[model samples]
Target chain A: MKKPIIITAALCLTGVILMGVLSGKDVEPGIVAKLKAKYSVKHAPSADHAGFEALKKKFTSPRQVTEACISCHNKRHKEVMRSSHWNWEREEYVEGRGVVYLGKKNAINNFCVSTPGNEGSCAKCHIGYGLDARGKGYTDQNNVDCLICHDNSETYAKAPDKAGAPEAALDLNAIAQSVGRPKRTNCGVCHFFGGGGNNVKHGDLEKALFEPDRDLDVHMASSGSNLQCVDCHTTKEHNISGKIYSLASMNQERSSCEQCHTAAPHGDSVLNEHTLKVACQTCHIPSYAKANATKMSWDWSTAGKLKDGKPYIEEDSMGNHAYMSIKGSFVWQKNVKPDYVWFNGTASHYLRGDKIEDTEKPLVLNPLHGSYADEDSKIIPVKIHTGNQPYDPVNKILIQPKLFSEKKGEGAYWKDFNWEAASRAGMKAAGLPFSGKVGFIKTAMYWPLNHMVAPKEASVKCGECHARSGGRLAGLNDFYMPGRDYSAAVEFVGKWLLLLSLFGVLAHGAGRILSARKHRNGENK
Target chain B: MKNIKEVLIYSGFERFWHWAQAGLILFLAFTGFEIHGAYSFLGFGDAVRYHNIAAYLLIVLIAFAIFWHLTTGEWRQYIPTTKNIAAQLEYYVFGIFRNAPHPTKKTALCKLNPLQKLTYFSLKVFLLPATLASGLLYMFYRYPEGGTTGSLTIETLRTTAVIHTACAFALAAFLITHLYLITTGKTVTANLKAMLTGFEDLEGTECEPEAEK
Candidate 1:
């Protein structure tokens, strides 16, 4: 009885001590509540975060990022103001389907929103702060204010770190030594769009940026590299043309690869320059075969095949399906075989002196671009009859013409004999290089050629080009050669590799079945 | 064996041109891919630098290769033909599968299979030439004797870009096939050995004592 009483007393004492230590009397929650109420965040925040929120406070000056420019270059400001950039604000709120207006005063941005006091990161691209704090109806027209670019007015103020930049003329505190132009980052921020969703138009935003592993975005944001957005994205009227495709474009097909490769394994005049611009993937990708691939495969066991791994082919659709300009669901790169193909054939150079006689049928010699083999070439037309689209009789093109050539003969030429040349020629004349959109993808948009088979769910758009079942059945395993047998070579190659290692193990096992010497020598086949 | 004047497969300048060209191409491919983020090999910056260096070097090498091939009459070697190609093809497809005799026998005088001859011909004359010309067009989009942007048509440039990309893919596929084919030599290492030592260990009894290198 005495022990129990003593234990209870001890426990009570321990609890009292614990409660004293755990009490919130020292935390000052009241002050925290006030802070939470005011800033809607935790207390003791970094000054920067507080400053960012302070942007909502009423500002007396309209001359921060916008007004500063009006003092000198009012014309440019008015022009920019008329543009779509100012109409984009992120302050749009959607609560239980509140009256959603889609334009002018409340236009929902097609992509990103740029608003103040909103955590919308997109605002950084086109936002302009007047005094940080915005009042009741502070038209963000003040956003994307003029001083950001040509700071003739001192309204735009870059940070101290950017001191080297010339001060805006509108800035009342202008410094004399300012001459910073819009750098690539200022443009790419929205172009790469935080590096996803939408990249810079017409070109890859960070084409070849360095140190991809580390957080180089900071450097991208602030490095102020001498590189300008215009360096690669040469100016166009409304729409800028990439240097390669435009008349002003300068890259020479031959020189371009060599510029980086440092050598010409295939030699000059190796590729045809006429009827096309020289870009590598144009020939490499062939066409998009993803949707049309009959037997999508992960295992290379069947390098190219139908679902059952059978060397079969679908019969062409019967509805008098004329070869329309946009032949639906046709694959590219027909006449595929396992062992021998055009790549194994001869080699030749075509230019002023070493010219090839133009032919109708494409030669099916080994066509691996001369990476292997020790043979000179003979000219033969490479034949092809695969791709989602066929020649357009009206315009004589593989695809419908937009702004340029209008003759039906202006596109991919097809007689159902040879396609590679036709495809190359047509693509050269019609297909948009990297533009893979359906109508825009002048090149074939089938599969297993340019790209792998799209995921099962993604390949449902065959009707976009192909005729229901007929197109599927006709080209099922059209890839299989008519009369070539590659099974032996395949088995031979793999078995030979395996045989090398098995030799030793087999030697020991052979001793039990027969003489080791017999197994080693065997009957000379 | 009838004595053939050790006719140069490549000139001194040509060999230098060839190796330099090959080296730069490999380097460019490696670096360019890294830049594409296909697979990080060298760090991004290093890859870009390496790619740029190789690209410039390739330009130099290509110029030399063009000059060498032009001067040496070696360019004639790429003349394409369809002669006996049908038979040679049969051997690669059906006959090869049956272990039948190869229709196109290899000799110093006739070193390539019919199919090989045709392929090399097309690559040199068509595919690769197209690729090179387009590549140059891409590089010079920035600076040239009198370069300007917006000069090339988007249609033209886009087509060229695709062609270039396609050529790269073809080259990659060829590389893969070549790697596999290297193992198909008489003794697996036979072809590689020939390339390295400039001699091959003849297989079977067809080895005329005089043919032994």
Candidate 2:
């Protein structure tokens, strides 16, 4: 009795001691500590430098501000002139083909089709000035619109018809006086409002980033790190480091998390090992369009609808525009989970003159090139924007229809609602021969999502990738994952072993019990 | 008249460890299967929590059991020997029904037969340790993101899970056989009563307690 009491006391004492020790263990500092330490020290450039005080007042046009900026900066305009933003053309070496000129000016996108015959409205986002009706602005150094990027004042507004120039009555002197490092507002003016509306072109970028909550974007959170555009996209001599998805290249120095964070940012080496094959955004961002819904699909066949002699507009359950006679039918989605793809940071575009191989399938306007065999490739999250656009069936090439009018006499599709006239005017301006046979074809554009990183704790859980079904990587069979992958032979053998063991145990136990009962009966006799 | 006598076979601590370990293993197996998506009795989140708690409790029970075995000299009961091994097998398979006597005599110091000695030895030295180590590795695989704590660098938990589950099946097999064999003793309730009372009934007066080896 005494020994039993002692044993019970000992066991209880050990349990209590172990529990106390486990409960007293201290937790380690998390990733936020590392981020806070890294970005805490920064040197912000002074906005009010004495050099800008001597500039001439009463500027009548944006050109005057550019001339003043070049007077002191000297080589600023020359550098801007050499950039693709100034020329609106990028010389790219396509696989199997020689060097091809591709950019917003030459590339035919499904959204707004092309920029050739609609320069006045399309060039509203252009960094240069006076991009004529023919889409030519490369000749003048004074065309560098400095105030568009450098203006700290929020009042600087550009007129769409003025060809990237500020409004006529706007105070250019006050805009020039408030020149400073570019803010999110300045960059968002074009990027956020791309494709004719907010959150249309890029699902990851939106106006909400100006003062985003932590849940929307951890880096640009107003209550947290509050990183600016230029922080990761480090620039030198006015040349930005990052490139759009249409112009990505492995050889170029692209903006990546590795700019500030190391390759192995996580403390767990297991997760760090994933960095070599999986992109940081694949797990961190999880989803895109957190604050606002973005355009998912567009069907141009539904266009030309008119109600009461005017363009009809339809709204979805969320009050988002579902259909517009001017733009056709659209599907909008919010908190959209991006599709995964292996990207090598290099993209190839189908130029305006390129022949369509398969018109029956959706033409990949800009295809991201990578494969599982590529060592440089990583599984990246991308928003696939699908739409239908006009193409010349006889010429076997895509057509860029003039969507907006430069003047009253111009044959714009929006003004006249005539496809043939618009196609004729657009092809003539682009210096391309059109057979006048027009048809709408399906097209897809890939846009990489790299923003709206959730808090580290909210990253993808283990089961999201390891489960057998409904996992994020369920469709990604390029590589094998543990719990998600299985072998029939191994499973079969395991089941057999378990069943055999149970059978053996049952048979042996029955034999022993029967023998013992027989012996008891014999003893009784 | 048949002579009957009672001898203490299990100490209070030994009985306590045996029952506690059994309860913990059952709980661990139940929770572990739920986590493996074998069933949906407990949700995944709750299954993981319960599995972890049961694993820790099992570890604690094993620790106390090991200490007791070492201190009380009960570890010698599992040192397997080939002596009378064939006789024990033969008796279980055929002779017992013919009113044959047990090939090996039970004593306070040598409570287990040769077969029990081998099975218990393997369970303690191999399967139990394999399950415990694999479970611990899976549990501590992740670390605080910014901390310098060491963690397993494996990309997937498939290998660890396989090893843990295989050991669990082996243990379940052992428990089934053990429960059945307990009924093959002198009476159906005799073995269970001994575990509860720390005393076993023998039909002969010739039995004597063996000296420590």
- The prediction achieving the highest TM-score against the true structure is 2
Fnat of model 2, as a fraction: 0.11
lDDT of 2 by residue, A168-230 (tens): 788777778778888888888888988888898889999999899999999988888878888
Model 2 misplaced stretches (Cα beyond 4 Å): A1-31, A37-44, A47-53, A91-101, A133-135, A267-269, A370-375, A431-433, A492-525, B1-36, B39-213
| lDDT digits (tens) for residues A1-525 of candidate 1 | 124333544553354335434431322345435433543322332233222322333334434424444444455555554443444321222223332322222221111111222212223344343322132223544454443443322334433212112223333323111213344444443444321222211122332232121122211222322223443344332123232110111212212222322222122121222102222322322223211212111111111233343333343343221222222222222112111122212122110111113223322111223221213211111222222222232233232212112233422221222233333343332232312222211221111121111221232221211222232212322122111112344334544554553553344334333542444456543
Q: Relative to the true structure, how large is the alpha-carbon lDDT of every model?
A: 0.34, 0.76
lDDT of candidate model 2 versus the reference: 0.76
lDDT, candidate 2, residue A44? 67
DockQ-based class of model 1: incorrect
In angstroms, how far off is A141's CA in candidate 2? Answer: 1.4
Task: Work out the TM-score per prediction.
Answer: 0.30, 0.77
Angstrom error of the Cα, residue A412, model 1: value is 71
Q: Write the per-residue lDDT of candidate 1 for residues B1-213, one digit (tens) a residue.
A: 344232222234543454445555655566554543345545543454345555655666667777776886566656665777788766544553344565654544445555777777776678667767766665443222212122333322334444555565555554555555555444547555544334443332232334234
Give the range of the ten consecutive residues with the poorest summed lDDT in model 1 chain A: A439-448
